[model samples]
Target: MTAPDPWAGILDPGETVLWQGRPDTRPQWAMLSPQRLTLGVVFIVAAALWGWQSAGLASAGGAMALLPWLAVPLLAVGLFNLAGHVLWDAFRRRCTWYTLTNRRAFIATDIPFRGKRLKSYPINRETILSFDESEPASIGFAFEPVPMKRSTRMKMVGFERIADGQTVFALMRGVQGKIERDFPIDPESLPR
Candidate 1:
């Protein structure tokens, strides 16, 4: 007897899974670069000073008592910039899972309190692939617009920090090649 399909309802007809993986969950110390370290330290020191100064005013007035509490958020932001961001990223990565199929790539994240999210990007002939050759490499094949305070920015979506990125990158390239071969677009169909 054959084994049951793990992605029976998840996958489309004829679509086969090429690879599945999870990123490294350990704390990524690389996130705390020199720039971030200096900034975090400065912000933390400033917040502490501000809070200390504001504490003395608590005896003078009513609204002045709340001034010290205002530094709490700043301190939190400073902490986040220092090492909290790295820890948060690791936590998020721990909840993330990646799956690559013949037709598409899937990123599934199940963060606590935030909920589960499953996003897929189609791997078509027109898809542009980007490979980051780092120690634990990354393969980016799609872009998702991330909303910022002022505007939205495109963020690369892919298999991040996977051990076997080269293999996955090759598989993605092969998928694109096979798709082009199977479904050739006629040159006569021109928009220009």
Candidate 2:
């Protein structure tokens, strides 16, 4: 079965499907609101103006007249920021991932241009569903109480508002239920 799109509720569900950790499947444009880029552009423009005014050179006036040239850096910075934000969003979505197949639950992390770490818990071994809802959500899977044994924890930083955090949690619960039913393990009994 195919997975649902993460942003289906926000965008055109039919047209917008998640790439499932595939970089090529991510949105071409930034996932962040354009307002962020607009703010960056404004700041860059202001900085350029300040620099132009402070130079106090006759040639600076000619340079100021060329606003388009001055805007080049601002535009570049804005685009770069936008791209970075998009990449960040894509990375978060990819990292905050859970796959439930007939066999087991597959959890993984994707670091753009870098390597990824993936782990699978046989339907029986996966006993716990734990997460941190702090400013940055930290999702993980563990079978032991010791903190170090739990390698499923994914560090998801910079995501202010998760697209559908509740739904994701619900899905995780459902998966946990399935694991419990199929396996004779008590999730709570597992070490922290």
Best of the candidates, TM-score: 1
Per residue, candidate 2 scores C-alpha lDDT tens digits across 22-110 of 21225436356678777767767765785566555545576555653554666567655656667666556655454444334455666
lDDT of each: 0.91, 0.51
Residue pair clashes in candidate 1:
none
Candidate 1 TM-score to native? 0.85
In the order shown, what is each candidate's alpha-carbon RMSD? 3.0, 12.1
For candidate 2, give the lDDT of residue 133: 72
Model 2 residue 126 CA deviation (Å) reads 11
What TM-score does prediction 2 earn? 0.34
Clashes of 1: 0
Specify the highest-lDDT model's number. Answer: 1
**Model 2: number of clashes?**
3
